[model samples]
Target: MALRLLLDSADPSAWAEWLPTGLFRGVTTNPTLLRRAAQPCNLEHLAELTARALELGAEELHLQAWGADLLGCGRALAQLAPGRIWVKLPITRAGAAAARALIAEGCPVTFTACYEPAQVLLAVALGADYIAPYLGRISDLGRDGHANLTRMQRIVESVRRVDPDGPGDRPDASPPLRLLVASLRSPNDLALLAAEGLDTFTISPDIATALFAVEPTLAAAAQFERDAEDT
Candidate 1:
């Protein structure tokens, strides 16, 4: 399939306006973005936001666990209606446990905050459909985030099973783990990942908007309109 462009925003208006464009694969949101969008309902506000996405015919609706502890995560998970929610989890001991429990129940999970091959491998072992490595966050620490993701991609590809000692299931041919690179900083960051052949990304609303408004593309469209008018 083509590269999946997803909006990583939680605003209800953003979803209502953007989903109709048919450019976004779906929406992905966290506690921070949702709070910025509106008063955080201890995540209770997400139900209406999700309903809006579904009403607009979204393909996927990804949400993050509001709390750090397993209980808190579970509480956050309970508020969401379960059609297409992929709960994002940390790689902590409690988080991994929650992810495995959810995975076993046939629920989709995206293991977030990953920064290394080990974490990526762990998510793959848990059968997480998506593993998100925070890109700009890693760069903030003066580390090479792209290099780290390269290593993660290698590790994900080498794994022969979804869960080696746990789920004990054979990995599918479609690549057991899908990388959803997060925390994008700019349009160049999006171009960088696309040039490197990465397929999925969770981009901020501003960046996603900027992506469709590049100078060259806009210029070409204007020229096409002018030529058609002359014709």
Candidate 2:
């Protein structure tokens, strides 16, 4: 299956054309993106944006929580944009607790700002639906981002093997916990991770375009077309 691509666009206008590409499985928005778009940090606004994204064919919508109060934020998030929404919480103690509660209530939660394998493990333990690790940020800190992701992949596999009946033993175990690689700096990062069998990636529109521009991908498409024509 094609690796699921999520568009990380701040400005809705910036994604107007990209949305029609039909390459994205979801959209992710955060405070920084909202600030760039000059949007308010309110549930109403978030719900509206999420609805709009859904209308544009986003299967999942990610909205980040701002304040330090996880319970309050989770409660509010649980009520906003009910369908196909993943409330993004930071990797904190309060956030984990809130995520656990929300997951138990059947609300999807995306644990963000994960920097270590331990963080991902904690999110999984809390029954999070997704985990967003900042790959570019880790690289900026002079760490090997791919290595970290590989480590996370291994840890996830190990856990699944030990406890096949664990919280993440859903039907789609291939994309376990929806490993959403965020903080992408370039298109190559997306391709590299996708090739590495990472589950999902959230990338800026510019990076998305660059990734779609890869020569090998285009060649493969052309070959498929040629074969279809011949047949």
Number of the top-ranking candidate, with lDDT as the measure: 2
Candidate 1 residue-wise lDDT, 71-158, digit = tens: 4565456447664787887788888888877776667788888877688878866778888999899888899987777777767656
lDDT of 1: 0.77
* RMSD after CA superposition, every candidate: 3.1, 4.3
Clashing pairs in 1: none
Q: Which TM-score value belongs to model 1?
A: 0.86
Instruction: State the displacement of the C-alpha of residue 21, model 2, in Å, after optimal TM-score superposition.
Output: 1.6
| Regions of model 1 farther than 4 Å from truth | 68-79, 160-175
